[model samples]
Target: MAKIVLITGGSSGIGKAIGEYLQTRGYKVYGTSRNPKNYKSSFALLPLDVTSSESIQNCVTQLLDIEKTIDVLINNAGVGITGPIEETPISEIKNAFSTNLYGPIEMTNAVLPAMRKQGYGHIINVTSIAGYMGLPYRGVYSATKAALEITTEAYRMELKQFNVKMTNVAPGDFATNIAAGRYHAPIAQDSPYKEAYGNTLKTMDAHVDAGKDPTKMAEVIFKILQNPNPKVRYKVGAFIQKFSIVLKAILPSKMYEAMLMKHYEL
Candidate 1:
């Protein structure tokens, strides 16, 4: 029997690509979004607002009713909120955390019972390269991914006894539709950070525009699912970006900090 796979934020971007790739590979795939009807794809589409516990419960319930078990759960729903912290509104930060961090936590909790009963399951959390180090105007987004990384690390250890597996996928800039949904905090006319923020953002977008195709990440994820023993964390992107983690670890704090600031033109 084909394994049952569930993915959040599946309507588009890396999520959609993953769903489609898995579907072609014979996994019974289900993808979720608050408005799933917006996009058409080969994989199953379900309505899910990861930020809402009730919605997650309902969606998982519906999936369980039909499939009875979810062999893999991919927490892929996330948003990018970019702005100078000093100028960004509190509400924006709240919204980012609610969706990026809390949503995954709720979804993971919702599926644990079923996974535990089944005695074998795998979870893939789609984090990002930015999660490693704080970005200039994207600290809030960084914080959310960083938090998710920590959560996944802990869950990996906690779930070992249950035979459940958890993996954190830290991806670099991928050519996906993520930018379309990104929330750019409103900049005040009088805000001193506005000019620098504006200049740095263009540099950021340019790099993203040149990012690898969405299919590259989908392929990496596909291989991960097939592995009998997968690594706790997998990063998909350029060598320099993937090695950033090591660079930060070994380099002197001030030196590495300067490199990041130079990269972002901060």
Candidate 2:
């Protein structure tokens, strides 16, 4: 029987690339997306809104009815909100946590029983390098991913005895619609740091425009899935991410902060 994998946020970016690549590798891929109209993947597309419990439950139920078992679950749906923590509204912060953190938690809970019964399953959460190193103007996004990293570690330990593996993939600067969505945050009219915030947004856009291809990250994920014992965390992207990790290890906290400020022109 072909292995079954379900990927959330599968309509575009890294998620879509992973779905397509896995399909070619002889896995039966089922992808979830809010809008399924223009998706051209060979695998199935299930309607899913990660923020909606009803939608997630329905999507999972539909898949269970068809496939009976899911070999892997990829939690890849997430959004980005950019602005200083003070400038970011409470509503935006709530929405960020809802989609980025709660969505994955809810989806994981829904899939656990079935996975546990099977005695074999893999759960891959696509986090970001931001989870490890905080960046300016991305407080909420970073917090959500950081929460995910911790949750992934906890799950790795708890689920291992049950024959379920949990892995977190942290990719740096991937080419995706995440950058476009960053500009959609409502600007705070009373924000004292308006000019700085605008500059930060501009810098982010430029970096994303020159980021690595999503397909490269997808390839790393594919290899991880093939391995019987995947690492607890995999960092995917350019050498800069490794360098950043090393810098964080060697540099003092204040010096590291100063270096980031200088590099980002903050």
Candidate 3:
């Protein structure tokens, strides 16, 4: 029997790319989108809204009815929000956290039972290097991912005895539709920081527009899936982007802040 893999937000971008890649490798891939009716993919399409408990449960239950067991899960559905820290509304930040952090946590809870019963499984949380530092206007997005990263650590420890594995893949900037809904700059029109925010976003968009191919991330994920013992985290992207994680850890706090401000032209 082919192994079954379920991915959230698999209708487009990295999630879609990874689903296609795994399908070609002989895994039975099931991908979820908010509206699966319109999604066209080589893998099976299912409906899911990760922020809702009932939706996550239904998606997993429906998949299990046909597949019997789920061998792998990729929590790839996420949203990014960008805006000046002070002006960004609490409601907006909460929404970002809902999809990026809470949704994954809920999805994991839904699938762990099946993975545990099967005696072996793997979970990959699609994360970002934004979690590593407080980026110019993506503070909320970064915090949500950071929270997921810390949770991944705790889950890894707790699941070790159950033959379940979890790891985070923190890609730098990948070209995707994530940019469209992410720019939360309502106050950019009138705030004193308007010019700075505009400049910072332009710089951020340039990197995103020139991001590495999504296939690169898919390739790395495929390798991780095939491994018997994957590591705690995987970073994928340009040399400097990946290296920044190390630099942040070694550099002093003030120095790191200065470096970030300089890069984003703050």
Each prediction's Cα lDDT score? 0.91, 0.87, 0.91
**Residues 117-202, candidate 2, lDDT per residue (tens digit)?**
98989999999888888888887888999999999999899998889999999988877878866634555677677777778788
lDDT of each residue in 134-196, candidate 1, tens digit only: 888989999999999999999999999999999999999988767767998777788888788
Off by over 4 Å in 1: none
TM-score of 1: 0.97
Q: In angstroms, how far off is 2's CA in candidate 1?
A: 0.7
* Global Cα lDDT for candidate 1: 0.91
Residues 33-121 of candidate 3 have per-residue lDDT tens digits of 99988978888889999888999999999999988899999999998899888999888888889999999999998999999998989
For all predicted structures, in order, the TM-scores are: 0.97, 0.96, 0.97
Superposed on all Cα atoms, the candidates' RMSDs to the truth, in angstroms, are: 1.0, 1.4, 1.0
